[model samples]
Target: MNSFNEEISSKLGLIRNTLSETGASAVRLRGTDWFAWATAGASNAVLLAAETGVAEVVVTAQAAWILTDEIEAERLQDEELPGTEDSANPLYKLYINLWADSAARESFIRDVTAGGKILSDRPTGDEAPLPSSLVKQKRVLIPCELERYRQVGRLASEAMTEVLSNAQPTWTEYQLAGASAQALWSRGLHPALTLVAGERRLPLYRHATPKEEPLGRAAMLVFCARGYGLYANLTRFVFFGSSQANAEIRNYASGHRHIREIEAEALNFCLPDKPLNGVYDVLDRAYHQHGYPQAIRQHHQGGTTGYLSREIIVNPSSSQTLAENMAIAWNPSLPGAKIEDTFIILKDGRLENLTFDPKWPSVKVEGRDRPVPLEID
Candidate 1:
């Protein structure tokens, strides 16, 4: 920790000293290779600068604005503007996500713009992957990183518990969203997908935005909490009235559990050395194992979620190998319900549920039926 702090301090001092110098105009920071492709790709350079697809989706347009303005200003005679609205949607979504918070707005700009600007000055159009294909040097996991994630996950579940306890039937969907966001913010985590599906809202639109209406009888409150470029995704449903169904609902939830097992089975054979494609191969069996024979049509199950919400999608054709220590969330929804949790693949080849709280309800995984809550109490 001290070493990291010293390194940062030294870098800061250098920046401060250099910025005041007349020779500093030529003292541009050599940027990270992460955005090299997008920088060289020029026109859509801004999108590449984002930390996540969601970030890119939200900032792409503004980035384009910056790029075009720089070009017009003769700041970069060689650079071309790389603007794609579809690509910018996530980045734009991130901006609106700040929800009028000035600090959030400033942080968003810093996280997305700093690196790209440095590379943009020297404009290239490579459009390379964020991590680059420097032939992955080796399979490695940072010890401190794993421990830090454990703490973050614990904090996330605790926040969820505290906020969920205070929730009331009369609270509006927007208010509930605020509750979750506040909890996350207090813990130094940013709320990514603070989506709430109130009452039967899930059946109507899977992308149900928070509204002013009361939670009615239930709510599907889910979010992607992030810090240090990593995320802990979780979903919790709350119920006010009797959440029991005749028999069909029971059967459906049971089937969902079965689906999760299928996902588990696929990951069983996954090894750190294997490429993503092999992990892709297991998802089919998991789908079939879960009883969704035609799983492709239902919903998109997430892929490796660490640096990106989805490092890659694991649809039938993808052959991306599962990397160890990689965190993932597989949410397969049916009707008015969904199942999700953030988990890390342990070195022992078992998945350690990072976001699972003792108070949070659980279903059966392995042999024992754990305390997984299917309905909001």
Candidate 2:
């Protein structure tokens, strides 16, 4: 079997076991994150604009079904579901439960509901929280997922760096965002989340989306690229004009001593068996130690990332523990300064920097090398 099919089979087994543990006989996967996890990369069925959550995949002990409209179902069956037709096809039982009629949809739901307890990510009538334990299971990267994350991270970093570096001071934040999105799309990755902030917007807004305001002297571009049913998030900065024009931004970058220290320590605390709250504790101390005690309160320090932008965010009150082979994106930001990257914690207690790009300029901050804002004349 191909790796993709293998992943589907393994995931089905895991899902069945999880459901059985919770006394649920079936599960209806609706959200993009959960659906992506089950199919192991099939995402063409998701229709974001429609509120109906039109596409759903229901899985039970013996079978799985993909419920969708005729058009989408046919397209997926033909182009995306690259599996054999024989009954022995590992994925042969994954039928596209098409809804050519309203009665058919109702019948599918009824049949599954009769099987036993049905859990759902997008619960409607009677479903429980998608087992928090399942989140931990999904966050841990499989081998194929690890390779896909690395590839996506590299491409995303390159796209962000190239687009932001080529941006002119006269360009507006929207224009910069446009260029960045185009770069990512050119590489066959969706620009799932794009945030662009300029010199005027940075210090004030932490998660600013692009605006018509010009980039002026400096700007920050953050991109979360989605492809292969995986996500890679990155941020890049650019400054324009002469040395003096760049000095203010340089000072802003330098002022991140506290944030950088917190970031590094948080990564260090990402060792196995360590709870996510421990990492948050280190961040809190580093923030207060550097005299920005309230900084962490302003935004979320990012968390484990893979199938979702943040599978499970780390907060001061969180109780989730770090696990081996987990991909993490710890983005600790304070005012005008922020440091962020995606890394994987291995079983051997080593952190692999997935988003590292040597072509991007770097600065040794808090004794660790990090991407520095690019300065252009």
Candidate 3:
């Protein structure tokens, strides 16, 4: 085995041993199982993504499987899921105790990745029920590395800033997005989303992909920058024409600025004695002030950081505590008129703006020289 893969396997065994002693089921999932979980979505995304109850993948020492119930009885009756014809998904990886004389872990990975070619998803032909213990569990795999994830975010923000500096009125939206991705890659960051919308397509969709058309008045970009199992998302708006383009757009821009001010103030609300929900409450109010009465549910506002965007978004109903060393990027954006920076919530209530509009020229925000992306004549 390669050195990297071997090292991964050894570490996985240690994790299993640790989990067995401390975790709920003493179960340790193989790295193969982790790989399976990530790419398992591709098949579903192409064919069965819309299918309900197909979201989560159950991983354990004994088994890794998805709910067949989501596969539409018609599709199941016809045959296996599209990717499972001779189903062997490389992406859905798991560790086989190649060195150990254990068939359970080895067969478990093989069977799940290949749709039970080696072992059945149900294990037996009998209808077995899921364990009651799994019902309350959440599947968030935090990788062993932390510094790598933050480095990706820092680099991505710098890339976006670089792209904005030379942006022009005639530039296509996707061109800008592609430049951003290239910049991100130059610094070793992964791109989860590269949405860039032109002025004509303003607010049509938040995850708007740019068309092969020229940009006019405005352009908006959003990115979920990733690395080391973490995501730091932020949005930017660029304008070429004068600021006196549209009344509602200008008004919304003012409201967007106000929303940022609320966000700036809410940074101090992160006291341990203060419920984390308090932050959500403040963000919700910011939306209302910015004329977006239904902003909370429209899209995920923000969530806990350090090992991917959390399963739990920071919403009003959330009660998760604000822990120290928890790096967060709370970005609330209005569709077209404007969006703001991705601020890292610090331990001492100091805010670090991860994505800046620096080098695009200036505007004053709370006694600071923030860049103004929307150029005015």
Using TM-score as the measure, which candidate wins?
2
Q: Output the better candidate (1/2) by TM-score.
A: 2
Local accuracy of candidate 1 as per-residue lDDT tens digits, 1-377 = 24333332333333334334322211221222212222221222233344322112112212322222222323223233222123424111212333234465335544654533322222234222212221121112244456656776788877887777678878988999999989998997667668887765755655578988887666677777765445677777665644474354454356456655765555465556565556555666566655667754567766666544555666766655566776767665555566667777677777777777888766666642333333544
Best-to-worst ranking by TM-score: 2, 1, 3
**Cα lDDT, model 2, residue 6:** 83
Worst 10 residues of 2 by lDDT: 44-53
lDDT of 2 by residue, 1-377 (tens): 77777888888888888878998878888877776777776674355423234466777777777777775766776765665223564453444444557677656777866846778877876666678877678888888888888898888888877897789999999999899889998997888889988989988888998999988887888887887767887777777876365577767766565566778888777898899888888888888888888888899889888877887788877788889989889888877777788889999988887776888988675455678778788
Mind sharing the TM-score for model 1? 0.63
Model 3: per-residue lDDT, tens digit, 248-345? 55754675576566555456565533566787888787777757788766666665553344434687777766654455656555655434444444
Q: Which residues of candidate 1, in runs, are more than 4 Å off? A: 1-140, 245-252, 266-270, 278-281, 288-291, 367-371, 374-377
List the RMSD of every prediction in angstroms: 12.1, 2.4, 9.9
Off by over 4 Å in 3: 1-26, 29-105, 108-150, 244-249, 289-292, 338-344, 357-377
- Model 2 alpha-carbon drift over 4 Å, by segment: 44-54, 83-87, 90-103, 113-115, 243-247, 364-368
